[model samples]
Target: MSIPSFLKLVEIQTKVASVIPFLLGTAYTLYRFNSFDLKNFILMFISLIAFDMAVTATNNFYDYKNAKKTYGYNYEIHNVIVRSNLKEKTVLGVIFTLVLVAVICGFILFLNTNVFVLILGGISFVVGLTYSAGPIPISRTPLGETFSGIFMGFVIVFISVYIHIYDENIVKLIYNNGILDISIDIIEIIYIFLISLPAVNGIANIMLANNICDIEDDIENRRYTLPIHIGKENALKLFKVLYYAIYIDLIILVIIKILPIYSLFVLLTIMPVINNIQEFNKKQTKKDTFVLAVKNFVIINIVHVISLGIGAFS
Candidate 1:
C-alpha cells in the first residue's frame, strides 16, 4: 500500500489521543520530579506510537472483515483496504511490522528501566492487541470507555511519569528468597491518578462521542458499543459530564497545590469545551458534530500540557 493508504489504514489522525496524554505525563514528571530521561522518553515515544498505530490498523481490519452494513458510504470509500484493494496479507504484514517495532523498543526500554515498565507495557500491549481482534473485542462491548480511558489515558500517563523515576521507589517489586514483595507509595500514586483524570475523561469522551454518533450503524453491524447499551440520551449526558469533570479535576489539583497556579489557566478552555459539548448535544452526526468531542479534548489537554510545561520551567 502507498503512504497515504498506510496512514489511513492505521487511522493516523486519531493518534492525537495517545500523544496528548504522553505529553501530559512527561510534563508532570518534569514538574514534580524535576528530572528528565531523554533516552527513556524517546524509546517510550517510539514504542507508544508504533503500538497505537498497530492497534488502529487492527481495529480497521477487523471492522472491515465483520461489518454487516456500509451505512450510507461504500466500503470502497470508507475503508482503506477496500478503497485501495490492498491484499489482507499486506495489511496484516504492516500490522505485524508495527507491533514488532513496538515490542523491540519496549524491550530496550525495559532493559534500561526495570520490571515495572515491562509489566505495565506488557498489559498495554495485550489490551491493545485484543481491543479489536479477539472473539469479544473491547470496542464492541459496553466497557470500551472504561478500558480505553484507564489504559490509554491514565496508564500511559502513569507509565510516562514512572519511566522517569523508575528507581525512585514509587512502586517496586523485590524478590527475596523466592518471595516477591510489592510496595507502593500510595500518596504519590493518588497524586498521579488525580492528575491523570483529565486525560482519562478526554479519551473516554472521544470513544463515547464516536459511539454516540455510530449507534445506528454499530447496531446494524452488530458492534453493540457503549452508546447502544446505555441509550443515546444517557451517553450524551456522560459525554458532557466527562468534559465538566476535567475542569473540576484541574481545579482540585490547583487547590491542592499539586498543580501550579499557572495550570489554572486551563480554565480558559471551559467556554470552548462547553460550546462544543452543546453543539454535540444538539446533533450527533459523524460528519458534523462528532468533531466537537475531539476539539474539546485538544482544547483542554493542549492548554493543560502547556501550563504544566511552563510550571516545569518556572
Candidate 2:
C-alpha cells in the first residue's frame, strides 16, 4: 500500500471514533484522581490503540474473506474491507497475534499478576476477538448490542481503571498521596462507575447504528445481528433508550451526589445526541445517514469527556 492508501486502510476516522472515549476516560481518571504516572499511562494507551486497530483489522479481514467467497472476488465490500499490500486474513492474524503479545507484556510490566486483572484481561481478549471472528461472532448474534455494551462500556472502563490503579497497595497509595481528599470507600468506586456510564452507552449506541447500516449485508451473509433480529424500527427505539438512559443515569448520580453537581456539564452532550436523533429519524437509507450519526456520536463522546474533565478539575 502506498502512503495515502495505507492511511486510508487504517481508517483513521473509525479509529478516532473508537479511541477518543477511552482516551477521555483515561485522562479524566488521571486528572481527577491525580494518578498521573506518565510512563504506565502511555504503555496502557499504546496497548489500547493496538488492540483497537488489531480488532478493526480483523473485522475487515473477515468481511473481505467472506465477500470474496460470496462474490467470487468482486470488491463490493470495499468500504468494509480495506484493500492493502497483504492478504486481509494474513494481515489481521499477524496484527492480532502481535498486539495480543504486546498487551500481555504491557500488563506484566505495568501491572502486577493479580487474579482480577488476569480475569478481566481474558474476558476482554475473548470478547474483542469473538466480536468479529470465531464460529459464534458476537457481531453476528442477537446479543451484539448487549455484548458490546458490556465489553466497550463496563469491561473497558473497569480494565482501564484497574490498569491505572491495580497495585495490591493501591488503597495505601491513595491514602498516602492524599488524592481526592477522601477515603478509599465504596462511594468513590461507585462514582467512577456512574461517570463512565454515559460514555459507555454512547459507544454502544454508536455500534448499534453502524450495525444497523450493515444489516442487509449481514443478513445476506447469514449473520443475524441485533438490528436485523430486532427490526430497524425497533432498533431505533432501542437507540433512543440507550441515549436517554445515559443522561438519566447521570442525573440520578448527580441527585444522589455520587457525581458532583458540576458534572452536569455532561448534559451539554444532549444537543448533539438530539441532533443525531433528528437526522436518524429523517434519513431513509442507512448508508446515507450512518456516517453522519457516527460522526455526531464521536463528537458527543469528545464533548462528554471534555465536560467531565472540566467539572472534575474545577
Backbone clashes for every candidate come to 0, 0
Candidate 1 regions exceeding 4 Å error are none
lDDT of each: 0.91, 0.66
RMSD of 1: 1.0
**Model 2 vs. true fold: TM:** 0.82
**Would you estimate the TM-scores of all the predictions?**
0.98, 0.82
Alpha-carbon deviation at 188 in model 1, angstroms: 0.8
lDDT of 2 at 205: 78
Clashing residue pairs, backbone N/CA/C < 3 A, model 2: none
lDDT of 2 by residue, 181-206 (tens): 32345655566667677666776776
Worst 10 residues of 1 by lDDT: 70-79
Write candidate 1's Cα lDDT for 1-314 as tens digits.
Answer: 89999999998888999999999999999999998899999999999999999999999899889988854652557688888888999999999999999999999999999998999999999999888989999999999999999998899999999999999999999999999999999999999988888889999999999889888888888888888987999999999888888888999999999999999999998888888888899998778888888888888889999999999999
In model 1, the clashing pairs are none
Best by lDDT: 1
Q: What's the true lDDT of residue 57 in model 2?
A: 67
Residue 238 local lDDT, model 1: 90
Off by over 4 Å in 2: 3-5, 68-77, 80-90, 93-101, 109-115, 168-189, 284-286
